[model samples]
Target: MKATILLFASARETVGAPSLTVELDENSTVGGLRSALARACPALIPLLPFLRIAIDSEYARNDQQIIPHDAELAVIPPVSGGSSLEIPAPP
Candidate 1:
């Protein structure tokens, strides 16, 4: 099965690409795909826990099975909400 993985923000910089198309097993799990990515790019392992995955625009669990020939593998990192709180600058 062929799938396209869309990377965002840090994930894109970590993998050095905005997107990647790869072949995966028809019954591959999200976790499995993550592991495969780690194997391919060791730099991503540390950020795996911080990353979120969505399939077909819906958030998916790590163990969620990937559907073959589908178009919604997007990697989303935690997004920041605007806040008025300010931190003190180093003196």
Candidate 2:
């Protein structure tokens, strides 16, 4: 089975594409997908660890989560943007 995973943000930038396709076993699970992706695209290995995978528009709760055939898959980029706190320096 092959999965065309949608990419976003840094993941998209790294792959130079909005999506990537990888071959997987018939009973591929979320964890298996990760492994296959890494093997298919080594450049994504660094970001793969932090990126969240959504199956059928829902986030996979755990690595063991199963992925059914023809299911929608996406590599959700890590979130950014939080106001930094500033502390006053004492004289």
Candidate 3:
């Protein structure tokens, strides 16, 4: 089976690509994909645990089965702070 993994943020930087295709067994799960990714990109091993995986736009559990042909897998790294605003003082 072949599936495409969409990389985001740190994952994209680490893999040096926006997306990648991987070959797996017919019974591959999310966990299996993780292992395959680690093998393909050693730099991603440290960040793998923190990544949130989504299949076809839905968050996937580690053991969730992956349907290579129909799944749109994405690897989302942890997000940090963004913009913030302060409350105005009472006059």
Candidate 4:
């Protein structure tokens, strides 16, 4: 089965691409995809644990099965805070 993986943030930087096409088994799970990704992109190995796999816009679990044809897969990296909250002055 062929599937497309969308990479984001650090994941994209690591793989040096916004997306990639991979061949996986019909019954491949999220964990299986991670392993295959690690094999294909060694740079992603260390970051895999911190990344989340989303299938069709929903976050998928490790054991969740992936349907290649109907799935829209994405590798979401850990997110960090941007700015500090400000306190408003009493009028």
Tens digits of lDDT, candidate 4, 26-85: 899999899889988998877777789999999999999997567799997866566222
Worst 10 residues of 4 by lDDT: 82-91
lDDT of 2 by residue, 1-91 (tens): 7789998877888888999999988877888888987998898787766778899888885555555687889987656545222212333
- Model 3 lDDT at residue 73: 94
List the global CA lDDT of all models. Answer: 0.77, 0.77, 0.82, 0.83
Q: Name the better of 1 and 2 by lDDT.
A: 2
Candidate 1 accuracy as TM-score:
0.79
lDDT of 4 at 61: 97
Per-residue lDDT tens digits of candidate 3, residues 1-91?
Answer: 7778999888998889999888878999899999988988898888887788999998999998897568789997766556222222333
lDDT of 1 by residue, 1-91 (tens): 7778898877888788998666678889998888777776788777777778889888889988987556579887766556322322333
Clashing pairs in 1: none
lDDT of 2 at 51: 75
Error of 4 at 79 (Å): 1.8
Best-fitting candidate, measured by TM-score?
4
